[model samples]
Target: MCGIIGVFGNDNAGRLAAVGLFAEQHRGQESCGMAVSDGLLIRLHKKMGLVKEVFHEEQLNALPGKIAIGHVRYPTKGSATEFNTQPHLVETLSGPCYALASNGDIVNYAQVRKMLENEKVYFKSDNDAELLVKYIAYRILHYKENIGDAIRNLMRDIKGAYSSVLCTPTELYMFRDPYSIRPMIWGKTPEGTVIVASESCALDTLGVQDRKEVPPAGIIKVSDSKIEVLDNDPNLYREGNCEKHCIFEQIYFSRPDSFHFGENVYAVREKIGAALALQDEGLNPDLVVPVPDSSNFIGLGYANQNGIPLSLGLIRNHYIGRTFIKPEQAVRDESVRQKFNVLPNFFNGKRIVLIDDSIVRGTTIRKIVRLIKDAGAAEIHLRIGSPQIKHSCYYGIDTPTTEELIANRRTLEEIREITGVDSLKHLPLTDLKTCVHCPENYCYACFDGNYPVGVPDVYN
Candidate 1:
């Protein structure tokens, strides 16, 4: 997954872009980049690190223009390297064009890259963003029309989920794939600055008002004082045009402050907790303790509905990276302890309800359960916010294979035994639909095996 931001008609565009990207730094941390257009030239600054590490006051000031685009990327579909960092810029025959960033995975990337390679269209990197840029540039070259027309035609050949922003020296463009698998929104500041970002929070941080979501398969163009909406493919809204959006966005990906399909994420997670309480009638815990950070919202939901006190039993060390290299089991165990420290006071002689978003491989859950149990908790009742993730995600998420997914091979009882929890319950797949207000608009392929897009042949 990745986060993208673009602004047009802003004086300190690079600085503004940095502020916006910092708000979305959670979406991606592998690399960060910003490109600003100075009317004639696109001044670019990108590096392999977090947004704060990559852009400083000097770097932001050096890249000066009225139009700027930025990206904070996590390596999901591509390798982690400087060459793969975005905002990818390419000088086409017509003009110097650059695509700031795109979210979601293109299932047809291999086929598209093969076709391009057959024509001797070489690429500097294996990043899908580069391939997407080439495809859009190819369409512009072949059609010989305005940017909107070229983009409209380009969408016809492209498949899979994408919400992206593209900018030229003069104008800024934003588009969402037909499926709308990823989130993108457009907002205009009170000062007449136009902005596009992966989430509304980015716009909120910049105090941009007049916000509206960029509709699926829709294009928004900003040039000087002109703003145009091009709707060449209205069929996207005609029902059954695509599979449901990735449901994981609500479960774990999006920020708690953000809203999805008009429903507050925190509110929905509470509903999931209520549903879990209903489903697991036997387990009544004294307190609800979250796994820290991402699961805090869901834990609150579970606590509120069950009338249980919510406590911060586990304190996460914010210093640890998401993944680490450990040469031995002893090192791995030590890493886990360093990553999270248990607050023994919260769990002492209390029946703890441990809430987490989802259990992927059960390793983390197992470790957490063991820690809480050892901390004098009478019972550890585990509840997951979402249903079991049985299948691997090809869209953009980096999940384990079917064989590695704990849910695929074990029942709730077996999983509880494996994790050494006193009892365990998962949110039912049916209740997952109710968690998000737009049930029809979500893709639960990972939980229910109903892929909205065609499953790739390689996975088969």
Candidate 2:
């Protein structure tokens, strides 16, 4: 997944967009970019670096505008290169003009790209954001459609998850796919600056007073004169008449401080911990230790339910980005070595219950277990917050093939043996649903393979 933000009606739009993107740096660490519109020209700047590194004070000063759109990418659609960095801008003969940034993958990318190519629409990068912006530009140029009509037609043809922000020289627009598979929230700051982001935490960082989700198949337009909300009938685009938000957002992707999908992210994590605790009736470990950061709240619930002391035995280095989202397997393997460490004098001769969000490839957690084991821990019982991820994800996450997934290759007992944990148990799929508010409204395709939107033809 990725993070996207848009700022409208703010004189320092570039600076504000930078701040919002910084808050969402955890969502993507590969690269960051921003496009600013000064009502006359749209200027773009993007590079292969973190938000702070790319959008420094000097860089922000170079871009002056009252409307901005930004993105932090994790590389689902293309390789990690400057060429794939987003806020993809389309320039006409006039100058640099329309720009777009999005979070989520396009399943029908190949088919759509071929269709556009046949119509003589050239492409610069293989990224999904490029496909989206080029598609809209094609509609606007060829069909003589306005921005709203172009986006509506895009919704009818595009089949995947996309929570995107598009900006013209004079206005800003925000829209989500009909499935609403990713998070997109918008609000107005007390100072009257309009803001939209992939997470509420970014809106909170900007001191937004009132906030709401961009409805499923919804489009919101923000111009100097007015702010308009245009919502479409979601049933016309989705298989069912209900929403199918990605369940992993609540389980692991979202920040604990962020709220979306009508539930607090941390609360859902805590409930998953409680559910795991309920399954372990009599097993009492000396300490409940969580793989730092994401699993902290889950460990808290497990500790609270089991009356076991919650210990910060594992300390995570803030400098290292999340290993799971690292673009390459070699990068991910190297990150686990630098990301976490066992607290000194801790885990010695102690039986510990280790809480982790989920075991994807089984490489990171296996190495983590080895770290705790090497620290002289007597026993380590690993508890996962979510159910097994048996299928690949096409909506945003980078689990591309089932062969790469540990669950699809090994049984639970085999996995436990491979990880070297004394015992291991993943939260049951049925138990996981109990943690969310409207369980039916979420997608569990990664667990049960019940894809809300049909898989791409490539998979078939």
**For residues 1-460, what per-residue lDDT tens digits would candidate 1 score against the true structure?**
7888998998898889999999998788778998899888888788998888889887887988999999988776677789988888878665666665787777767788888788767788877777777777766666566778766765776666778888889889998877778888888899999999888889989988788878878899899969999865647432476435677777877787876556677777777777776775566778889987788988887777777789898999875534221223364466677788798566778988888989876767788888887888898888888888898777777562577678889987899899998877788888888777668888888888877766544465
Off by over 4 Å in 1: 234-243, 321-336
The most accurate candidate by lDDT is 2
Q: What is the TM-score of each predicted model, taking all chains together?
A: 0.93, 0.99
The residue-level lDDT of candidate 1 at 267 comes to 78
**Global local distance difference test of model 1:** 0.79
Would you list the C-alpha lDDT of every candidate in the order shown?
0.79, 0.93
Best by TM-score: 2
Per-residue lDDT tens digits for candidate 2, residues 1-460, read 8999999999999999999999999899999999999999899999998998898889999999999999999999898999899999998773336999999999898899999999999998999999999999998888888889989999999999999999999999999999899999999998899999999999999999799999999999999899998767888887878899999998888999999999999999899999999988899789999998999999999999989999999989999998876778998999999988998888899999999999999989999999999999999999999999999899999888888899999999999999999999999999999999999999999999988887876777
TM-score of 2: 0.99
Candidate 2 global CA lDDT score: 0.93
